[model samples]
Target: MQAQTNKTENNTNRATQINARDQRVVQTVGEAFVDDPRIVCRDVNVFYGEKHAIRDVSIDIARNQVIAMIGPSGCGKSTFLRCLNRMNDTIDGCKVTGTILLDGMDIHDKQLDVVPLRAQVGMVFQKPNPFPKSIYDNVAYGPKIHGLAPTRSDLERIVETS
Candidate 1:
């Protein structure tokens, strides 16, 4: 249809306009908000010292909904994803400012412990990091430390089920 073609052209125009972007986004297009959201992020911003890596981005991730974050390289996809569980906190001089809530709990709260939070929500990196020599150790490590399994037998079962 002509309308679909026009939309693609418009999107291409927008992409071409954003050459080496520096200014913060005033707003996002499309339906960025949703009803019955499980994760709510409002005005989320990330700064690596002086560089504003992620500008004022906002969105609502609805419960049981599949969402995809598609963008070119260095557009802050990974940086913004790290903001979800406060992974940016580990990086020295990397700061995040805004409201991000996971099921109404403020992840940015200083009093919140990151260990369990990480277990609850974490990133599966593109490549496995420092995996133990054995594939079994790599699979069982998380369950072992998290006390998911009470005994070696249970750990084996868990790994097998996985």
Candidate 2:
């Protein structure tokens, strides 16, 4: 209980630091644009009612490249990543503005279906998210639903390879 209380206090301090940092109009480090970007975010902002969570953020993430989100405890790393897949939509009073594109398609488009978009672009958490049953089912679930494999043998092979 003491440790939990300490953690909460620490996070509160970090949140205050993050808020102060966001007030500075410093230029973002590194090049913000790229030619072959799989994901593009432009002037992205997030608000929880009146509180600005993320401010004027932009970046280009190229395909087949790995990137890390590193920051202080309350510095909006998860908030920005959530914008990539519209996970923020589930949160009440959370609103995201500006643009996010995946493979040149608008992620925030009202006409875009979220289910298949999520299937195409998904996040891997530190903990594995599995079905109730088996390892094979967990590995094969995506391919099975998307019809990536035409036959049972192919599915088995895909599972084995995974």
Candidate 3:
């Protein structure tokens, strides 16, 4: 009985040690990046076959901050913007590597779907074209399509908010 008790105690101690180690690893990783992040791009690169579009780039965007990328044409500002939503997926021979994280989750992971990811992150085009339809129709379209509003009155409220 004493030998069995010792064996059980040894197993319990091992589990406790493992749990402690895991907690330390989690804490260390969290602390390493959490001090500053609204966006973090690490060693990001984009290539179109032999053509390199974006070189290794690392940047951080803090909360409530605006980040702008400006450069001559073909310098990868749009390439990098498309990278945010994996829009590069459509281009032939386009390849992207390294890591881009939003709120600390890998955006490029195969498990992450781009559609909803885009809806949440949101995007407004650089152009200033207004909707051709009436303001009411223009504003109502999104909520109606997405079923965000169940009734006409609800859609009216959404259009007003827009």
Candidate 4:
């Protein structure tokens, strides 16, 4: 009985800690917009099947300014970031709603192709998974696949400059 009581107390303490942490996170992100933002996200929500992941999130990312999303585990920081570039589209039963604008253009517009949009807004994953290719091939793949470089010499120049 004593052991059970101790466990219950510990769980209560953890819950309290999590609540306080969430409050702090909300306060920190209260002012989510910036002047002259390069990217704008409004009323964004994400749902995975029946699980609601992100809720009514709105923010602005300013040009040349870096912003970090800080929150407790499972607080939807990654989900929110993935929504910016529509990376969540690949997931099964993952639904995202809201407007994400890049340079005043809607990224999710029907006329806008995803391939070019992905290239324009680059995403760096937390895990490093280098492609199984030569260093030059890895560096040149994006430009070659996207047809950004029209010739072999152009590819070489791009790789060198990068």
Report the Cα RMSD per candidate.
Answer: 9.2, 10.2, 18.0, 10.8
User: What is the Cα root-mean-square deviation between model 1 and the actual structure?
Assistant: 9.2
For every model shown, the clashing-pair count is 0, 0, 0, 0
Off by over 4 Å in 4: 1-26, 128-162
lDDT of each: 0.65, 0.68, 0.58, 0.65
Model 1 lDDT per residue over 1-162, tens place:
000101122222221112234522232344556667888887677888898776555677778766666566567767777888776775778999989898899988889987777766656655445332377877886787678999889998999998
TM-score of each: 0.61, 0.61, 0.54, 0.61
Off by over 4 Å in 1: 1-30, 125-162
lDDT of model 1 at position 123 = 65
What alpha-carbon RMSD in Å does predicted model 3 have with respect to the real structure? 18.0
Candidate 1 TM-score versus the reference:
0.61
Which digits, one per residue and each the tens of the lDDT, describe model 3 over residues 28-96?
111212346866666677888887666554555566755565445545567777777776775678899
TM-score of candidate 3 against the unseen true structure = 0.54
Residue-pair clash count for candidate 3: 0
Top model number, lDDT = 2
Candidate 4 matches the true fold with a TM-score of 0.61
Stretch of 10 with least lDDT, candidate 1: 1-10
